[model samples]
Target: MSNEHFSLQAEIAELENILRTIPEEKAISRLSFESRLEEARSRLAELGEPVVKEKLQLTFRGQPVDGTSGILADFGGKAVEVFSSAVSTVMASINGDIGERGPVAKKDADKLMITGTAVGSFGFELEVAGNSNPLFEEDDVTAGGVVEIIQDLLETAATGTDDEITEVVDVIHPRALKKVSEFLGFLESQKASCGISFKGKSFKFSNNSQLSNAALKLKDQNVKERPVEFEGKFVGFLPHSRMFEFSIRETGEIIKGKIGSKKIDIEQLSDNFLKAPVGVTLNSVSVGEGKPKYTLTSASDIRAKAGGGSQPPLTQE
Candidate 1:
């Protein structure tokens, strides 16, 4: 087996051993047991295979909600099939799983459509238009695809301008508007401006704060620490932290601007200089003030924009 696979197995084994040692007495602290369980589960997650059955929940208007009719695997397969089949079949499947008295009427099926999909730690949730047909086939839908669609939708809802937000509020269902707005506000507070990505239906949101890189690298114990460097355009200054922000040209990932102990008056720099291209190197990063902070070891290759006039490089030795 590959080294990575072997290491993951070893970690899982260690966690399992630790879990076994934990006493099963009622006197055991609930927090202690929960902490151990969480660690074990996380290590097992590194195995990259579903280790436990995922619960599924389905909700339909005019029908009793079925919170746990089946496992995620079964539900995922059925969802794909429903998306691909005729509208009638989709209605029948949903009704059958929920123990509804009868198949939905033709009028209801016409209203059936996939409103939205969201992924959580436990599983995925799908919102449908009034008995709406998702109009997707088994071949076209995958768990990852569902996640991407949701992430894109959420990002749009979160980052859109005020005008856009108003339009979204007017268009989306009233029930979902509040949730979308709340999630958007949360993302803003967390500085999730680098956008949201996913791993196995779980979100990995990127932030524009200084300590993002370090936090991401250290967030998973299974991940090894390493030096990171990137080239990007000096975007702007965050006066609140007295740092200059850079936008990675290739990935669009924002580099939380830092100057370390270097004595440079960023406010004195011209707007063009602030917008020049820069190279940044980071190591031994940490989080502070609710954001990632890192050593500003050096900033090099400062290139000014064409026609913006010549200016001194903003490199730090």
Candidate 2:
């Protein structure tokens, strides 16, 4: 295990070296580091991020959403992405406590040590937004914002006689609090109501007659045709095609993917190309196993701290 850990560390250092070779001037784009960082994090997680996550109490505008579950979705398998602003960066060195009577080589190997940790929290605000139906006739009240919706409903219930907005908050907030509970239950219900489907289906990996013919000659009666376009952030090699052209985003993310002059939504691509090596940039992640500690990486971006303290306070803003 120790050897494997060292090997992985060496691999990361090598990757860093490769990235450094890319000219600094060329890699100065604001999105470059983020994109690359996401990619690295994704790959590392796949190889084993060695990081951890903890279930967080969810809330929105001080109103307890009732239920919430957070997954290191990018790192683990769950997906309840919360905006984490409170990140604490730490660096420490531990001295060798076990003294040795032998030569200095043993001491040298165990001596000076430096390690850094990025800790932050990922929080979710439970607020729902909906667009007014175009077919419906316009009404004086709107159900767009959560607070507004609550206010509108309360006003109607009281016939505009009593104040329900503030009262509702004051009453429900303590009862539910900010921590959302029963997250997986909600997800299960959603799954039952709305089937989870990826958009990028029926993608052909190759167009060569040999490859295409092989696919056409599938023997698996239950096998379904895959529909996903394997693509890249910066460049994509046409495994088998005449020519390819597309505007590449400077951030190495993506503007749009054009296949034979047809635009495609990247989200659709992501869904279709699930399990394709993806990169992710995290503000922070928890450590330890189930009840882990969280460390922040993109502290500034996560919190938008303005030279004040560490990060922004956790509040639905």
Candidate 3:
């Protein structure tokens, strides 16, 4: 989507938040925000995108909360961290941060606004600042998509069977799944239950200890990692994605993986290593069922062997 659309969507969401949360007694402030919201909605309509009306609610109960009145400050802060991190990781995964290289930069992405508070339980109502006109399609990386996954994750944690949990996690990005584990850890520690309400549906898990066991089951026991040294022909590398391709000398098969090291000059890799013979040290991580993922740790120009031996190492972990 265009930057204009993105900015306008964010503005609309912010104005709606102000209008929703501002007290009725502050009529002047509410009026101004309402006017702005209307203008934003008009422009969005002119652009052919409809304004989004749905909002997601997160409610907390048990030890950390006191009905709809209040909550412990520290506990609340930790919840925010866990929730935000979970959302951010899922968003990143959706935006193509699948490899182990690193997390995608989320600074430009829309922020979740605290539009209002929920009754009957101490919680907050949330909406993404620019998500009303999501840039991505459904079940993808858009704000709506992220929230849906979060809802599924929470619901699974609460009532899903072990096999169901495994099935649900099979499609989730591992980094995002790690965040899910962290959230379960928080819930387990506080002995609290969380409820996610969206699209007129709600899911909550009250048994904290059971949720903790779910977290353990979420970890993939079949996954393993080992360090190895090998010779390969550097095929290509994309610095932006931190993805690389190498042709194994022993097998002539090409493999792709993320390049995570910072010490190596990425520019040099592109300029000198393309299709060149190189000896590389890497961490091979395997998930048992799929091809192993290689993380380059160090590399040396094997082409230099013609002169005498390998050149000075090109990278150091």
- Cα RMSD to the true fold for all candidates: 21.7, 29.9, 11.8
TM-score of each: 0.23, 0.13, 0.53
Per-residue CA lDDT of model 1 for 70-102, tens digit only, reads: 224544444333322332332233222212244
lDDT of 3: 0.68
lDDT, residue 155, model 3 = 74
Model 3 lDDT tens row, 186-258:
8778988788888777877666666666666555564345677667677888878767888888998888766
TM-score of 3: 0.53
Among residues 3 or more apart in sequence or in different chains, the pairs in candidate 3 whose N, CA or C atoms overlap within 3 Å are none
Segments in model 1 whose C-alpha atoms lie over 4 Å from true places: 1-227, 268-272, 284-293, 299-317
TM-score pick, better of 2 and 3: 3
Given candidate 2, what's the lDDT at residue 42? 62
What does the lDDT read for residue 279 in candidate 1?
Answer: 55
For model 3, what is the alpha-carbon lDDT of residue 160?
64
Where does model 2 exceed 4 Å of error?
1-120, 124-136, 140-143, 147-317
